[model samples]
Target: MKRIILSGGGTGGHIYPAVTIARELENVEPVEILFVGTPNGMESRIIPEEGYRFASIPASGLKRKITFENVKILCRTAGSLWKARKILREFKPDVVIGTGGYVCGPILMAAALSHIPTMIQEQNVIPGVTNKILSHVVDRVALGYKEAKARFPVQDKCVYTGNPTRPAIREAKRDESREKLGIRPDDFMVLIAGGSRGARNINNAMLGVHRHFRDTPGLCLYHVTGTRDYGNVLKELGEVDERGYYGSSSRIVDYQHDMPSAMAAADLVIYRAGAVGLAEVAVRGLPSILIPYPYAAEDHQTYNARVFVAAGAAKMIEDKYLTAQELIQDIEELHNHKDVLAGMAEAAEKLGKASAGADIAHMALELAGKKGER
Candidate 1:
């Protein structure tokens, strides 16, 4: 079996791509895939659930500002480098693939020092610090955006493969999804998602604006409030719908695990512009209104949103300017403009790389010079 160690986690953006790439590799080879990530990070749960072996290392990010905690994190990271080395030695991976997170730092560093072939996948237009640092040591860098090449130190080693999106989202058919989601053929369906954990700002805005949609004609709303805010959201919705107000027009889900069905059923998507969400929206050709998280590392979510805006695929509403009234108006205006929505969807489709997982998997295999064995 060809052994591959993939490292990344903390968020679905980092973990999902690693999982997608691993799944793709399984199709071509009898693979032994090990995922190395921080124990507390989301990958610890997500990776193993996907039926892959997962190893945890003591990894944490250093704060940008000067603090004792930052120093302590740095010391811990150095120790993690040693622990990661031991794991790599015993597993003897043929190749290492890092998706981009602090967890990748120790694992990729160990792989590099061990003289193992290493590759990094950068998920944003502005590469993360982990992938940027790995670029110097890794054999190849796979990028989500072509423009990312200029931002990386090792431009020559980079290839734009786009980000690997969930297979369900990539292959979702519009009509089939709409049917599955119980969306009427003529209904103007709007999808509002705040990501897996849900965004507090987004939930608040939606609550403030719920009345407008309740009164709108022929408009349907599918609201995905993250699990964290589900109870509060349900309470608010109950208060609003108590008077028979929403008229068969809204579905409030705490979380929609079947996001492809939601995306496929929607005429428009309002979401945070995380890298994974952006890739899924683009692949599904869904025009979106993006509200980027301002506090994201290096303000990368804004950069991610700008990519779609530049492509005429999405319109960005800064978090600071977001209000329930403003959100309602924007949705109403967009819904009224079917031509623009269709145009944006077309533009989004143009930027889609539906087979990014297969592309990156093939690249990793080529870097390892391994023939298919599965």
Candidate 2:
């Protein structure tokens, strides 16, 4: 059996893609897969739960500016490389792939130096520093956004494969999903989420949206306020009942565990512009109102949002200027114009790479086969 090692962590954006690709690989062929990530990252827990063999190597991000702490991190990175190399030697994998994160740096770099077929997947228009550096050494760079190629020095190595998401995302049926979510067939379901931790600004803005849409027939607002802000958001909207319903049509929750179903049920989405979320939205052909987190590293979320905007798949509202009024106006415009909404949905569908996981899986196996040939 071909052996493979997949490494990436730090956030869900990095972790989920690795998991998806691993799942696809298993479906494609009989392979032995091992995941490597930092011991402290969420991957340490998530990968094991997914029933994959996982190994952890010490890894951490470097500070941007020169500092004593950066020096210390460099030393730790050197140690990480040693550990990663040791793992590779022991596993004897045919191919190694990294999604994107500081944790993957040492692992991918070690694989390259060991002459193993290696690749890195970047899931944003602006590549992370880790992926950008690894791009120079790895055999191939799989891009979530085609626009990201210009940002990398090794242009020939880059391929636009799009972002991988849960298989359920592509398979989610609208009717079934809506039924599961208690949404009517004719209800205009507006799904609002701000990532796993929730965005306070988004929660705050939704209060106004609730006030406007409450009791509005044929409209339902399913808002996810995140765990930390749920109580505060509920308190501010004092009339909300114990069940987190503000009006006849509005429902609030701290999190949405069934996001694929939620996305399938949604007629429109208002959320942050994280690449993973965008990938899910695109696959579902849902038009979005994107409010990028202004503080994201290098403001990459805005760049990701702009790609959708340029494609006519979504509208961008900078977080600095995102008000309930602005959000409500955008929603009303889309709700009122069926032709425009349909066009945007078509555009989003055009951007979806539902085959991304399969493509990357095949790519990894192809690289492994080539190495075996050599």
Candidate 3:
């Protein structure tokens, strides 16, 4: 059996892709996949829930500004490298792959130092500091966007393999998904999400959107409020409508377990510009109104969203200028023009790489096979 180690963490953005990649690898190959991540990251819980073998390693991110805490982090990172190397020696993995996050930095670096084939996946247009630094050493650099290649120094090593997502995303059926959710065909089926933690600004704007569409029929809005803001969001939503704006056709919740089905049912997506979310959107050919989180590292989310805008797949709404009025107006324009929406969906469909996970799985196995040949 070919052995592989996948390392990534810090957030679901990093963890989910690694999980998807592993799932794809296991589907068609006799592969022994191990996930190496820090216990403190989302991967600790998520990886285990997915029934994958997960190993924890000590790691942390370095602050940009030099300070006492940064000095401490530097020491910790140095220490983590030894731990990562030790894990590598023990596991004897044929290949190592990193998606992103600081947790993967030490592990990927160690793999390269040990002369084991290593690859890092970049999920955004503007390359992150961690991925950018490791791109020089890794055997391959898998990218989510074609525009991202220019940001990396090792151009030849970079390949546009697209971003991987859950297999359910590809197999979801729109009619079945809509029926499962009790969403009417007339309802617009707008998906508004800011990830699991929720975005306060986006939530604030949605308060107005609810009132704006309160009486509008065929507006099937599905909102994921996120756990952090669920309580307050519910309380305020009550002030706008005693029924809480939720009925058989429209609903808002702290979380949705069936995101794959949700993607299938959605007619439009209004959310942050995370690569994973956009990948799902593109695969579904959903036209989107992307509101990028301005505070993301290096403002990478904005750069990522711009790629969709340039492709006519999505519209960019910078967070700094985002408001209920702006959001409502854009939705009105798109909803009123069905042809335009269809055109945008076609553009997004052109950019979808639904087989991304399987493709990357084959790539890693090929590299491992080459090493075996040598």
Candidate 4:
């Protein structure tokens, strides 16, 4: 049996793609797969729940600013590198794939020094520091956006394989999802989510816009105010609605267990431009209004947003200029111009890659010279 090891963590963005690629590979043949991630990252919870064996290393991220913690983190990272080398030796993987994060840095470096065939998947338009370093050593670099290719030195081997998403998002049925979400056939539903942790700016803006649209007919708002901010957002909205009751036309959820239903039900999406969120919107071909997180490393979220805006798939709203009234006006503009919304949806769909998982898996298998089937 062939064996492979995948490493990534820190956030769902990295973990989900690794899981998706592993799933695709398993369909091709029986294989032994091992996942390596940090002990406390999101992968600890997600990978096991997905029914895959996972191992954890005592790895931590280095602080960008000068601090004593940075030295401590560097020592821990070196120790983790030693542990990663031991794991590589014991597993003897035919190939190793790193899906971008601090956890990946040690593992990929170990694999490079071991002379093991390795690949890295970069999910942003601008590569992360981990992937940027690994790009010089890895045999293949799989990119989620074409714009990322120019940022790396090993451009010859880069493949623009868009990010992978949940299978449900790829195969969602529009009417079924709308019905499941209790949305009327003619209602223009707006899906508002601020990635997994929720966005304070977006929540504040939405609160401001609520009063103006409290009685707007044929419009419904589905807001997923992350669990942490749910109570405060509810309180703010209560102040605006006064009745403490938002009618059937508005739903404020802490989180949605089923995002595909929400995405399918939405006529438009207002969200942050995190790589995963943008990729999901693209995959679903939904028209979006993106507000890039200003503090993202190297301001990469802005570059990611530009990819969509340049394609005419989404509108960009800078965080500095974003307001509740401005967001409402933007939504209303899109609402009034169905033709423009349809055009943007078509553009987003044009940029979507439904088979990215299979593509990345095939590339890894090919690099390993194990073309059994796929």
- Tell me, by lDDT, which candidate is best: 2
Candidate 4, residues 37-127: lDDT per residue as tens digits? 9988899989999999898888776777999999998999889999999999898888899997889988988988888888999999989
lDDT of 3 by residue, 190-270 (tens): 988999889888988988887678757778778888999978888886742444355443477788889888889998999
What are the clashing pairs of model 1? none
Query: In model 2, what is the error at residue 356, expressed in angstroms?
Result: 0.7
CA lDDT, every model vs. true structure = 0.87, 0.93, 0.88, 0.87
The reply for model 1, stretches above 4 Å from the true place, is 239-245, 370-374
C-alpha displacement of 326 in model 1, angstroms? 2.2
How does each model score on TM-score? Answer: 0.94, 0.98, 0.96, 0.94
Candidate 2 local lDDT, 297-361, one digit each (tens): 99999999999999999999999898899989999999999899999999999999999999999
Q: Best candidate per TM-score, number?
A: 2
* Cα displacement (Å) at residue 333, model 2: 1.0
Instruction: Report the lDDT tens digits of candidate 1 across residue range 206-309.
Output: 88677666656688888888999978887776753542234477777777878888888888999998888888888889899999999988898999899889
Question: In model 3, how large is the Cα lDDT of residue 208?
Answer: 82
Model 4: per-residue Cα lDDT at residue 50: 93
**lDDT score, candidate 4, position 310:** 97
For model 4, the local distance difference test gives 0.87
